[model samples]
Target: MLVKELKKNGLQVELKVNIPAKDVTEKLNQSLIKISEDVEIEGFRKGKVPLDIVRQRFGQNALNETLDELVQSSTNEIIRDKKLKLAIKPKIDVKNFGEEKGLEYIMSLEVIPQFKTEDLKKVKLTKFVSEVDEDDYKKTLNTFSKVQQNFEKKDGKKVSVGDGVLLNLKPMYENEIVKEAQIENKMTIVGNKMMIPEIEEKIIGSKAGDKLNFVCKFPSNFPNKNIANKDVKVEIDILEVRVPKENTLDDNLAKSLGAKNLNDLKEKVKKQMQGELDNVSKMLIKKDLIDQLDKIHKISLPQGLVDYEFNNIWAKFNDDKSKGLIDDTDKNKNETVLKKEYKLIAERRVKVGLILAKIGEDNKIEVEESDLKKAIEEEIMRQPDAKDRIIKFYTENSQALASLKAPIFEQKVVDYILANIKIEEKKISKKELLKK
Candidate 1:
């Protein structure tokens, strides 16, 4: 076989490969022998078929199969020999294949780029710190009080617009009503707008033994195909009046929430607030780190890698738009602009990933079995009756488990950098702290 480098441009390489006719004949002969041993003929004994007969029956097919296997194996062998870190699978196109000149093909692929990362110590980053105060504790206490409160049946009273009530409801659309259902004394706040906004408003002033009739028009984008953009009339039956009850935060209440006393509960609330603030600060700091990395790095991304990143970003953008999280004003913009902007993000991510990998390798940073086990246990504790499920999920998805290692690895890297860097604690107003 003869090999020639046809093209080399920006991580992309095209190569021309040619195999001798004798080599093709040898592979075809071997395949024919295998077929002859496997086939069952009427007059000939097993493994006794003549070479001429076997070649006459399946020669072309055998040659095709042999060539396919040879192309796949030889291309991979060539890539390994050349030590090319390919980003995607190589594409092969046969230019000429016959008995005389043998088989010739062209293969194209993208190889990984090489570049040195900037020194980590030279990078400057600030991690914001927000300490929980008395106000934050009081807010947490109020939230806990609401969670501990329960609803009870109220005596005879008129259900006003701002009142809460329990009721049963069944809505029907059009002349033909194929489905009917009932809600069993479900409590609904009258002015909370849980159901149809128009119907909820109409039921606000209803009293016991009073029947309210209202029609709600479903939006065009409603999920129910049959009822979408159509009018649905609902009859609501008021059962009982209900109100939210307030609870006092005492020793008993604190004990119920896994605390020793009111003081302990307050301390816990403060710690929780501090944790949330720390998480927000970390996110802000990470964003700044990426932005700075992108600004400083000057490496050019391969077209293939840029395309891959754009597809992911485009998918996420469309998903957010469908969920009403992104404005429709920017939906029809050019993808090239999006690609160019997001390419920086991709480059930063790639640079960070490579830096972390190098740090881990040079320092011999390893994720122990115990750490992975602890992480899995923490995940299991989050779900009800999900221990087996969590284990099964981790077992089935080695890639996800490997991703968990990245966070552990990155944290170690960051901790190392923070230990060596100069970070001074700064006290600021709550408003300024939150803005960070």
Candidate 2:
């Protein structure tokens, strides 16, 4: 076997490789013999086929298999010998290959760029911290208890203020049906702020399968601009109704909500709300931290890596565009312009990922088995009835299992930096912390 450098650009390498004909023949013959051992020719025992006949029957297949094995081994050998850390899998362009002529191919690959880590002490980041107030806790508890509320069918009964009604809505402007604004199967508490006063009043004595047509004016600041501040013709089809079960927030209610008692329920509500807010805080700081790191580090990103990331972004963009799901701002931009702008986003994402990986490597941070176990446990808790299926999915799919490690490893790296780097915790109100 032999190797020679064809080209060496920034983080990209092209190498020419050749394998000796003698080694190729030896490997090809062995492959042929292995295949012959598995064949049972007519009037001949297995493993008893003559070499010439086996070669005649399987020479091409054996040669192709031999070349593939040789190419992979040669590629690995050169990668190891050159000490190249690949950003992606190498591509092989075979120039010439035959059992008699030996093998020749060009291996092309992008290597990870080398750079110095910026000093942590010089990088400053702020983490916003918020304390839950009594009012906020009470609001959260009320919201969660609503989630746990039980409702029973109000069969053959008239619609009431506190009843939940399943209905379809259609509104018209200038006597034209607003197809785009029509809503189906919207569940609403009759007198809730979301329901219009005139509409709710009309539905008061209506029973199941009843229809009502009326006109109502919406507020100027209505979320759906189709009917905002306008007197529009309205139609409602009441399908069913349910009345909420009245209960005090005591031990029975707490037990129904998977809590020990009323006090425990309050504590759980506050904790859950705080946990969710803390997650939001972490997310905000993480974006800022990545921006800070990006500003400090200068990396000449490999074009292949950039292209790979861009392709993923562009593919998703195209997919969303096809589904009419792209944001309003993105909708007006031309394809070429969107591609150019998104390419920069892809560049940033790739740079951030590489930096995080490098930090984790430098600090010897790793995702432990316990981390994966806890993650899997949390997933099972989310889909309690599918515990076995969830575990089996992770167990059988190596890619899915590996995907779980990426975020965990990244968060660990970020936490390490936050702990060691220059940082300050800014105390803020819950409302301030929640601001976008």
Candidate 3:
């Protein structure tokens, strides 16, 4: 057996391999011997077939088995000997194969790029710092208050902001009713931004039993492509209005939410808000680090890796299109345009992934079994009823276990880079931190 590197270019390699005819013959004969043990001829006892008879009967099968085993083993040996980290399985093409000629093949494959990571210490990044201020606390409390609000049926009352209304809505396009757009007993809250502004405004100030006719022009970026950017006539029948009762923050409210007292609830809310704000801050800093890394390092990406990622993205896009859940960015675009855009995204993702992996490798970072177990435990705690089932899943499913470990590994890598980089903490308002 002989292996020779034929070409090397930007994470891709081509190799030429040759196996000697004597080795091939030996392997073919060994396979034939194995086959003879299981063979039965009408004129002979089982497992007593002659070698030449077995070879004549199953010669092609033995040769094929030998060729497959030789190719696989030779490829594995070459990869291991060359220390190649393959991004995908190698493509093999048989160039020459005969009883007298032995075997010769070409193996082409994509590998992880061999490149040094940029100096983390030289990467400058800004970390936005924010805390849970009184206003943020008050805002969270207001959310809780809204969650606790009770609705009282208001017969004969006109619809108003903050009131829930049940209505039968029929949408018409071009003077024809859209059967799929007709909804009955649709409960919408006024000023909730659920309906278009114009339609919601028209619904308000209308009493029960009032039939309101209005036209709303759907936004061009609407999720549903059918009615997007089109003027639709809405015929609304206001069935009832429900007014919300004023909510007061008190001990009873706190107890209802599993808190001991109002003060305990407020403290929990502040802590939760602080944790959320910290996570947002961390995410911003991580993004900044990733962007910096992307700009500084110009490594060639593996095409196979990029294509794999793009296939996943494309599959999801097709699935969404089938469900009529296409996003505005892709709603009106042709498949070619969508593929072009998604391919760029896939390339960026693959590049970033490679960079992170390299960093993790350089820093000797790893995800421990304990870390995975803790993560699973935390997830199970979030849904205690499914604790047993979740445990069973993670234990049995290797893919699920990897999915759980991926984020943890990524975060650790980010943290390592963050520690090395010069991050300037810039104090910002909570609103600024929360901004998209």
Strongest candidate by TM-score: 2
- Residue 307 local lDDT, model 1: 69
Candidate 2 weakest ten by summed lDDT:
140-149
Tens-place lDDT digits, model 3, residues 1-436? 8888899887888988999999889888999999999988899888899999998999999989998999989999888988989998899999988667899999999998889988777689888989888976898887877798777789989888999898898989977876655769977889878777878888889988999987889787766688888898899999989999777889988898899999999999999888998989988888888888888999988999999999999999889889999999778899789899999999989999899999999889999999998999999889999999999999999999999999999989998888776778899988888894
Compared with the true structure, the alpha-carbon lDDT of candidate 2 equals 0.86
**Per-model TM-score versus the true fold:** 0.73, 0.79, 0.71
Q: Per-residue lDDT of 21-138 in model 2, one digit per residue for the tens?
A: 8888888988998999998788778999998888888888888899888998889999898898999999999998887788999999999999878887778888898877889787
List candidate 3 stretches off by more than 4 Å: 29-59, 98-101, 142-146, 149-248, 332-337, 378-400
Using TM-score, rank the candidates from best to worst: 2, 1, 3
RMSD of each: 5.1, 8.1, 7.8
Backbone clashes, each candidate? 0, 0, 0
**Can you give the lDDT of residue 343 in candidate 2?**
90
Model 1 Cα shift for residue 21 (angstroms): 3.6
Name the lDDT value of residue 27 in candidate 2: 87
Higher-ranked by TM-score: 1 or 2 = 2
Residues 1-436, candidate 1: write the lDDT tens digits.
7889998998899999998878777877898999999987779988999989988888898988888977987898889888987766788999877656678999999876676666766668777777777776687788888887566666767766646688877677766551433355687777665666666777766666667667777666656777777888777888887667677888888888899998999888888788887887777776766566556666656667666766787788868878988666566668677666667666666656655655566667778888889888888889859899889988899998998877877877666656766655666556677776
